[model samples]
Target: MQRQFFRYNAKSFPKCYRELATSSSIFLIFTAAIAGCTNSSLATKQQPATTQLFSPQTHLASQPPRCQTAQLSVSKVSTNAGAGNVAVIYAFTNKGSSPCNLYGYPGFALLDSKDRPLKGVKVIRSQGTYFSKQQSPRQVTLAPNGQASFEIAYNQVRDVGQSCPTSEKIQITPPNAYHHFTLPEQINPCTGQVRVTSVQPGIIQ
Candidate 1:
């Protein structure tokens, strides 16, 4: 009886040892998997980020300068008559160091003895042989120290009383629709019409 009991105890001891070994192997695998997951999460959080910056030297080098005007002067004036009206001719010269490109129409304002602005002055295009609101002289490319001419007509001489001064004030405006590389200058009041024959270089056109 004693021998049979010892044999049973020995057989049970081997089975118990096998079950303990299996449980220990499973626990070790689960702990290793959890440690690997934690390491991956930490690496993702520690990654670095990127950014950009600007400097003064880079900003200024990217921008362009503004346009400037050249000087202008009135050179000559002449007068003529239509069937029932009078006309005045004006010659202007550019005496600047740079070329000037003329843009848009040219108009004039007649001033009374008191310097009051008068309206209804007509600009005539001798080259076109026609009349309109105002003649934007051709896009004249005036070389440094060059000259150009334009005419103004008064449909009725009576519009300007006999005592009125022959000269008129003129303002040469650049084309509003386009960007000008150079600007136009203002012509002071002169006899018959404002004549711009000479101008300082770098004057706004």
Candidate 2:
């Protein structure tokens, strides 16, 4: 009798109602699948992208190239003495056809009469000393055939000591540059300190 009752109810139900129930179940399943797919897509987008690493040399190589050493010319313009110090002005001229930038203090080294690198002394960037007031470094742009200047200051032999270091050649490397040029001029570096100024636009007076 229970089986007969169940069969009778199933048969009594409208065919459309049965079909609707089946469709509803299918729709619910389809909706859940769509929602799950959407969530997966969102998670993919939220994930962090893969990053690439680089070394200092690699990073610098990736940047826009700066002025090269071959595109510049270095020369000495003047030398002066006052108090217990000597000031020497060196000029940097851009020989390249395009404009280039110069920044920071130039790297310098003293060379002896034999054109050998001087020892026990290194070039130091200075905020003006007794010889010259402190001058801040600034970016100097040079057009083709344009020029910039920098000064070096050191103490005299008498002020430093009888055994002061003497240099007949000055080697100069532009700021952030590797190649250097030499100035075959007589210079006596005192024991106090050697001061180097940043590149300046124009001829040093």
Best by lDDT: 2
Best by TM-score: 2
**TM-scores of the models, in the order given:** 0.39, 0.66
**RMSD (Å) of each candidate, 1 decimal:** 11.5, 7.2
| Full-model lDDT for every candidate | 0.45, 0.80
Count of steric clashes across candidates, in order = 25, 3
Which sections of candidate 2 miss by over 4 Å?
A: 1-3, 6-65, 157-161
lDDT of 1 by residue, 68-176 (tens): 2335555335555556544454544656776655543443444534454544333332332223233333455556676556554444333444543343433442222
Residue 118 CA displacement from its true place in model 2, Å: 1.8
| Residue 174 in model 1: lDDT | 29
Q: Candidate 1, which ten residues in sequence have the lowest lDDT sum?
A: 196-205
